[model samples]
Target: MAAAPDSPLYLGLDFSTQQLKAAAIDGNLRVVHQDSVQFDCELPEFRTQGGVHIQEDKLTVTSPVLMWVKALDLLLDKMKRAGFDFSRVRALSGSGQQHGAVFWRRGASQTLNQLHPDQSLHQLLQGSFSVADSPVWMDSSSTQQCHDLQAAVGGALKLAEITGSRAYERFTGNQIAKLCQSRTEVYRDTERISLISSFAASLFLGGYAAIDFSDGSGMNLLDIRTRSWSKVCLEATAPHLDCLLGSPLPSSSVQGPVSSYFVRRHGFSESCAVLSFTGDNPASLAGMRLQQGDIAVSLGTSDTVFLWIQQPRPALEGHIFCNPVDRQAYMALLCFKNGSLTRERIRNECAGGSWETFSAALRDTPLGNNGNVGFYFDTVEITPSAVGVYRFDSEDSEVSSLSPQVEVRALVEGQFLSRRLHAERLGYSIIPGTRVLATGGASSNKEILQVLSDVFNAPVYTIDLSNSTCLGSAYRALHGLAAESGASFFDVVKNAPEPQLVATPHPAAQQVYDHMLERYARLEDSVLRKSCT
Candidate 1:
């Protein structure tokens, strides 16, 4: 039977670094409504810049827990005022910025279960967190903890083999260790430790939501193979850590129905299922419908490249997470800190601050930029730990300068080439029918995408939607409904709009980039070696 026009809806929410966003989709998988609350602009009382507070040491970064609660209250109120029928929402799932930790107070679960419909969530739950300022993903103050953790598990390689990642300073386990060591009282008072993804789902679940396998892989504590917490890692980090973290759940697991507080206050149906939420990147993998042979390239403030893998080769440089969609599969991620901002800086310096002028330069220069490759790192780069600009000529000799047009082409080409290099280092390769799914601000520019296509030697594709993560969460919600009945993630989203083919590799692209890649690798190594010396 065909569904009615006013059929059940699924809601996906994203608790990002700077904002909280939501997208609702109907049974047909078309977006019905979208909304967001920007923390910096909407909540000035918090006085947060970029929705976070960087401590005096500049290494500790945090977001006020109550601020997120207040933003949710405000977002729901706005939706209610807009006459969004919450009763029609059959299920909900979401994504949160990865690696951020939230510490629940001893009696926080009680406070959550007893939420009053007449009161705002922020008002009732202001004291629910043992740590008022939760350490976010931007924090890098847990270096000591990261080292300690890596040592506890033998070494970085051993840890990565177990947890799907090395002990990154921003990872939740290290952050927890830092708290336990630095703030002993706070750690003692913390009843439960939830990653940001599970923490948001907890609000709707009326208790605690188990961290999904996909997001739990970000912490250096999960045994990704078993999809459970590692006892060695837990004992090394803190006392009774497993009790505080609870058990890990599958990403599509139906947590339960929505809380009574939401049903009474916002008219949500009592039967509305809440699915386990995952990390923003994993959610995006679902949204983009990335297949086994596809690579997803996000060119936002920080460029990120991710892909689905049947067998993961965990490394220290990039991250490997349990695939959110396929229980038996995994995903790999490579981050480059210098993305749009670096492009913008180059555009301003060489093209008078005009993307139009910048693109014109790209069209003006030939492919491979006459074998003039440049590594431009405005700030420190994450993938290859390097800084400053280093230009190399066709002969692989370091050069000091190039023409403005050449500089422009070199910058764009270098960025994509580096992505390909590192992605391959993580065991990613271009097979027949491989597609590059591109998103983020820079993806809209065809000229830039042309370079991306040429470097990877694959057809480039782009999605029309601006928020893939939120949409992915919505898709996850619907998948949760069908998962128990044995529907695959692809089966659930078969009707999703196909990504538009933005660019295709030039016939000669393989020949040109094949040689350029070798030279680029040598130059990058030289730069890194020089930086050390």
Candidate 2:
């Protein structure tokens, strides 16, 4: 099982919220096989609704650590069923949901290195984690932790300047501090801590995986400019946290060989390399092949808007993470918690759980929903950090209710308009010259895309594949392979495919959205103020 003689294939895995997905592609970028293992459907034993457990509070979301290990085992089996030859894969890389923490038991590295192929991974690594449940981005139970960390480091703005964003409740730093405070013994026994991406890579590399800079940025613990963990922030989180969280590496760093267990069980070549895993958003930027003027609008479980940038100009409004593709650059991002699930809620209520009906409702309404806008947060939103549903009418005044059609249109418009406003603040503009690259589950909806284009008043484009994060990881693998061959990353992935223009703005879209965005900003401020009062 040392080495296999064959054409090189690259494998990319995405350990996203709802599932574990893998994509295999050849040197020419032809997809050999794409598959997934859904946590809710395939692994019903875990009983995850959206690949997470709801302990006590609805907002307290976490996932079982052993469930992820078993998911990997099942995923590899799925690849075998799909006729994927693992030995032919030259390099592997991965993407994972951001801001989630994974704790490792003192001897976890040994547990990983000595994985028994004969036994299931979950059975062997049963006690590998100090904490059984890992906190994910969806969990907002760390508000007190967030305030404490920010107060410890000068203030919220100062922390934002040092790291990427202000201490948000879902950030890994806050989550870690909460864990350390709540469970002191578990913290003491923990040896290594990882971002979700690093945790997945550690399994493949048979050792502690260094957190990638791009993913590390999401933790609110990495200095965005230095690309290193901040000692000051570490002190704010927990005791001896510096050693617990290993060094951060660039996304392009070659982690090591695929674990011997993989070679023995799955027939992967011993020489196969593993690249540092990155956060899903950064990986999507790689998959979309975004240019200077193009913006990425990913609409999955969490909706986000990001654009590539050159400098690390940290802002309090959004995030500035080191670009996964370029070690010398940065990317700006604005994430919203109310995404596909909230959209589905509205669709189910207003459109009778019919997409066609939802589309019809979305399209028939005039642009700006005839001056009706609303903020719908089924969960706590990241930016305003507020929850609840608020409706406004034509005169920009609060309303008790609206028709199903109006409500549907308001929800879609409100979501994109919020993105548009924040994106512009981050120096991304949507004009005739620029374009929005749409990706994720909701990207295929023409109605939604049209709303996006109109709200931003720019053309919206999508590629053949909707799940760009998984493919992005594959592209990163190929890029790493090319770099090892003395080739440029652009040269390696340039010929893959181009984004197809899907929607153009309505003639009056720019004017309508301009007014709506301004109105939304004011209403958003008022809502936050009222809630605090």
Candidate 3:
């Protein structure tokens, strides 16, 4: 059935590592209904005693494609429950985690239902290659592959220039290279390779796969400026890898219709168009209404800080990533792998399970935490840092050092100062004149926000939406559809509610932070020199 001409709706999906969330909005961008379903990625366990490792079973890191089908079913069921007409949904799209690869054979003529119904698809592919258990973006066992690619491509800087990012252990290119080198037989049987975003789109549409620019940019195979797959990168990294990695389609392109299986199982209209998929981070930026000069800092399990720049800037040496969100915009990002997890760990083990207790203890310490003594908090540092991992130690070598409470204050102070230093190196001006938008779990913490505002000397604001990534994906889907039809993107976003609160920097606190930032930089430099050697 075709969608109603006047009341066409759009659907946006936020596909995370653990679940899939779907949101539907009408032609006017008013949300009709939203629903989500949890799924598990069955990851294998390995034990290491001393330096020797024992694989108890074949490490199966599996997230069934069936989970997505189930999620879509649930979504449609919820929409129906909410009194929505299935035929009203005209366009559908999604955002997924970047860098995961999914594989399928070209000659398999069976529809998704026939293949997936009895779980025979798993059995069929298992005979040829590792069928299920696609390695997700979080799998970081490819460190050796990263080093090899860096060496093959000359060096890390050269690789960064060509790939628009430093060689990361979790990138798709490295993962494919590792498989080719270690499991040559399996690599020979590989037919087509695609990122999770493209694969999910293909599953829904029942055909060949193609990813959008946002997801492709994360694979390290795309030339950022060209917005296309790099033949040079393919040859240098994995020559035998399938070209079915496919050309990157624009985010607005209509991939195809929901498969017969999907329509039959979930009762979706046959006319629903599956829009191209994007990465979650870019979706979050879109959701936050990030434009040029607007920075979005997400403090999740890991902290990611990024901004949408009008033009592509030269890649920074440290931990900078330049990912293209669309043809006209590029997102410059930094990822702190152990961001909130580190803070939570400190709260639990060091501060006795309460952040309030920790904050209170930190506050009891004086400004500058006494004199010149400083703390280094390196749980994980992402930016233009010479160092990748975090380590904490005192800056001053004096016998009469600060007390433990003062030491904790210095640690928190240094963490914020470090972020400020990194922001500046990436061409971001950390001054009171700019407004910084904070999101994720950390934004809810008043103490954290206050510290961040003071360190950057900027007003920190949090939007009304808590799950900005999901909201951003939905907003992007709506905007993309609207733009295709010559409608206004700003008009849709402007009507949304303003931030709940804004925290301004304290002048006296800013003075203390300014001096602390300099000393922190020097300490960071010394640590980097030691680590690099």
Best by lDDT: 1
TM-scores, in order shown?
Answer: 0.94, 0.83, 0.80
Taking every candidate in turn, the Cα RMSD to the unseen true structure, in Å, is 2.3, 4.4, 5.6
Lowest lDDT 10-residue stretch of candidate 2: 1-10
lDDT of 3 at 117: 31
Better of 2 and 3 by TM-score: 2
lDDT (10s digit) by residue, model 3, range 54-80:
234433133444444455555556667
Model 2 quality (TM-score)? 0.83
Of models 1 and 3, which has the larger lDDT?
Answer: 1
User: What TM-score quantifies how close candidate 3 is to the native fold?
Assistant: 0.80
By lDDT rank, best first, the candidates go: 1, 2, 3
Q: What is the clash count for each candidate, in the order shown?
A: 0, 0, 4
lDDT per residue for candidate 2 within 1-533, as digits (tens), equals: 22223678999999999999998888778777899989989889988889999878777899987778889999999888877889898899999998899999999888888988888788889988998889998899999999999999999889988987889888999999999999899998999999899999999998899999999999989998888999999998998888998789888989899989889989999999999999988888888877666788888999978887664456678887888887777788888989999999999999999999999998788987888888898887876588888888888788988999999999999999889777766656554468888888999899999999998888999865466888889999989867867776678898887888999999999889898888899998887776666
In order, what lDDT does every prediction score?
0.93, 0.87, 0.64
Candidate 2, residue 516: lDDT: 80
